[model samples]
Target: MSPERFARINQMLDNRQIDLTVCLDKVHKTNNIAAVIRSADCVGIHQIHAVWPDIDMRVSGNTASGSQQWVKTIKHYRFEEAEQAFNAQNMQILTTTFSDTAVDYRDIDYTKPTAIVMGNERDGTSPEAIAAASQHILIPMIGMVQSLNVSVAAALVMYEAQRQRQLANMYGTRKLDHAYCQTMLFEQGHPVYAKACRRKQIPYPSIDEQGQIVASTEWWQRMRAPDPQALTC
Candidate 1:
C-alpha cells in the first residue's frame, strides 16, 4: 500500500462509528437496500442489520455502488434474532412508525448507542418491531403525502444521528476493536495479497507502519508455492 492510500484508510477507520447502526425490517426491495447501505456508509456506520425472511431478497451490486465494500451487512432470518443481537450490543432500538407514543426523530439523543429500525416500502414496520422498539420515532410531514420513501426516511434519521454525534465530538477517533482495525487495514491496504492468502488458506501477515508485510520466511515460501487445487479450477 502506498503511504497516501494507507493514510486515507487510517482516516476512514478513525471516523468509524462503532455504536451507531441501522436495522431493516423485511425491506425486500434491492434499490432500497442498496440506498440504505450507501447512506450508512456516508454517515460512518461500520455495520448494519437486515432481516430477510425471503431468501430471494438481496442488495443489487450495481445499486450498491461499491458501498458494500466499506459497510458490512449482518443478515438475520428472523426479527426476534435481530432484536436479540441489538440487545446484546446494548443499543437503544428506535423504530420509525406513526403512533401516539412516537416522538420526533430529532428528539432522541444520538450520542448514545443507537439502532434505528426502518420498515418495508409498503407494509411499514412489522408489529413485532413496533412492540419491541425501545422508542418509536417519526419524521413530521405536513404535505399531502404523509410518508416518505423507506430509504429517504432512513437517510434523514441517519443524518440526524450523524449531526448529533458530530456536535458531541464523536468523530475523528478510533473506536473499533483493535483486532478488527488491523484486519481491515490489511485487507483494504493490500487487497491482492489478502485475496491470495484466502485462496491458499494461509493466515494473514502483520503489516508494518510503512505498509509492508511482516511475515516469517516459512510463510513467504507457502505464499509463493503453487496451489495444490489449481488443477480443479
Candidate 2:
C-alpha cells in the first residue's frame, strides 16, 4: 500500500464511532438501503444492522456503490434478533415513529451510545420495534407529506447523532479495536493479497506500521499454492 492511502484509511478508522449505529426493520428497497449505507459511511458509522425477512430484499453490489467497501451491513432474519443484539450492546434505541410522546429528532441526547431504527418504506416502523425503543423520534415536517423517505429519514437522524457527538469531541480518538484496524488496513490497503489468502484458506498475516505485510515463510508458501477446488472447477 502507498503511504498516502494508508494514512487516509487510518484517518477514517480513527474517527469511527464504535458505539453508534443504525438498525433497519424490514427495509426492502435496494436503493434506499444503499443510500443509508452511503450516508452511514460519510458520518463515520462502521456498521448498520438490517432485518430482512425476505431473502430477495438484500442490497445489491451495484446499488451499494463504493461505500460498501468501507461500511458493513449486518443482516438479521428477525426484528427480535436485531433488538436483542442492540439491547446487549446497551445502546439506547431510538425509533423513527410518530406518537404522542415522540420527540423531535433533534431533542434527543445522541452523544450516548445510540442505535437509530428506521423502518420499511411502506409500513414504517414495526410496533414491536417501537415498543422496544428507548424513545420514539420524528423529523418535524410542516408540509402535507406526513413522513420523509426511509433513507432521507435515516440520514437526518444519523447526522443529528453525528452533530451532537462531534460537539462533544467524540470524533477525536480511535474507538475501534486494534486488531480490527489492522485487519481492515490489510484488506483495504492490500486487497489482492487479502483475496489470495481467502482463496487459499490461509490466515491473514500481520501488517506493520509502514503499511507492509509481515508474514512467515510458511504462510507465504500457503498463499502462493494453487487452490485445489478452483483447479478442479
Candidate 3:
C-alpha cells in the first residue's frame, strides 16, 4: 500500500465513531439505502444495521458512490433481531416516526451511545421497531408533506448526532479501539492479502512502517502452497 493510502485509512479509522450507528427497518429502496450509507460515512459512522424481509440489503454502488465500501452493514431478517443486537451493545434505539409522543429530533441527547432508526419509505417505521425503540423522534415539518424521504430524514438526524458528538469532541480524537484500528487498516490497505489470509485460515502478516507487508516473501510462498484437503480431492 502507498503511504498516502495508509495515512488516509488510518485517519478515517481514528475518527470513526464506535457508539453511533444507523438502522433501517424494512426499507427496501436501494437508492435510499445507498444515500443513508453515504451520510453515515460522512459522519464517521462505521456500521449500519438494516432489517428487511425479502429484499437483499445490499447497497446500490452507483447511488452510494463507493461510500458503502467504507462502512460495514449488518442485515437482519427481522426487526426483533436487529433490536436485540443493538441493545446488547448498550445502544439506545431512537426510531424516527410521526407520533404525538414523539419528541423533536434535536431534543434527544445524541452524545450517548445511540442508534437512529429509519423506516420504510411508504409504510413508515414498523410497529415492532416503534415498540422496541427506547424513544421516538421526528423532524418537524411545516409544509403539506407530512414526512421527508427516508434517506433525507436519516441524513438530517445523523448530522444532528454528529453535531452533538462534535461538540463533545468525539470527532477530534481517536475513538476506535486499538485492535479494530489495526484490523481495518490492514483490510483497507491490503484487501487481496486480507482475503487470502481469511481463506487460508492464517493470521494477517504484519504491516511495515511504509504500509508494505512485512515478510511478504515467506507469506506469499505459504499462501501459494496447495491445501492438504484439496490434494486429497
Candidate 4:
C-alpha cells in the first residue's frame, strides 16, 4: 500500500507483454496451476482466466507469487464463466486438442486478442469448453505422449504469441492497445502505483497507453525521479 510498493507493482505491469489468457480447466493439482502461473508471467502475460471450481493455492505455491499483484487473474466458478468472460472481450480462445480441425500451435495468429484453455492434467479441456473455444491448437509431438506438462505447453505457445505480436509491432507503433495495457498495469501492480509514480517524479516504466511494456524505450520519455517518500517503506 505504500508508494514504494505501489511503484513496484506498476513496474511489473509495464513489463507484461502477452494478452494471452490461460484457462486451467478443472486443473486440480496445485503445482501444475502454480507452475502455469509462473510460466504465464515469464512470457509477459498479465491476465489468466482460470476455471478454479475450487480455488486451491497450496499446490500452486510460489508459482503464483506476487503475480496477482500485477496479473489480474479472473476466476470462474464454472468453465462457462471463463468462456463468457473472454468472449465478451472479443478475445478468441485457443484450446490444446487433436480434433480434426486442430491447427498447429505455431499457426495461431497470436496478434489478435487471444486466450488459451489448458485442460486438466489428467483429462484436458472438457468437450463443453472446447465447443465454446474460438479455435483449437495442438503441439505436434514425435513421442507417444500427446502433450507436455500444462506449464510447458503454455510457455511454448505463449512465446509464439509474443513472437507474432512482435512482428506486428505490438510494442513499436501498433503497441499494446490502451485497454489491455491499462488493465495489466492496474492489476500487475497496485493501483496506488500510478499516484506513486507522479509523487516520486520517476519515469514510470515505459508503458504503452494500455500499460503494456514497450520492448524498446530508447524513444520513450526517460525520467527517474525518486519517490518523495522513498526513505519510508
Best by TM-score: 1
Write the residue-wise lDDT of candidate 4 on 1-233 in tens digits: 34564565455545565556788788777777777777777667767877877655344557777555545567788988887888787889898888999999998888888888888888888997889878889999999877798878877887888788767866433235566555445434434655555575544454454434454343233223444476586
Instruction: Quantify how close model 2 is to the true structure by its C-alpha RMSD in Å.
Output: 1.4
lDDT of each prediction vs. the true structure?
0.92, 0.90, 0.87, 0.70
Clashing pairs in 1: none
lDDT of 1 by residue, 41-95 (tens): 9999999999888666678888789899889999988989989988998999999
lDDT of 2: 0.90
What does the lDDT come to for candidate 1?
0.92
RMSD of candidates 1 onward, in order: 1.3, 1.4, 2.8, 9.0
Candidate with better TM-score, 2 vs 3: 2
Off by over 4 Å in 2: none
Question: Considering summed lDDT, which 10 consecutive residues are worst modelled in model 4?
Answer: 215-224
lDDT of 4: 0.70
Worst 10 residues of 1 by lDDT: 54-63
Model 4 collision count: 14
TM-score of 4: 0.68
TM-score of each: 0.96, 0.95, 0.88, 0.68
lDDT of candidate 2 over 79-131, digit per residue (tens) = 88988888888999999898998999999999988989998988999998999
Weakest 10 consecutive residues of candidate 3 by summed lDDT: 52-61
Instruction: Give model 1's clash tally.
Output: 0
Candidate 3 per-residue C-alpha lDDT over 1-233 given as tens digits, one digit per residue, 9 for 90 to 100: 88899989878887789889999988888899999999999999989999978754567889999888788888888999998888888999999888878999999999899989999988999999899889999999899999999999999999999999889888857877777766777788999878878877878877766787776677789888886557888
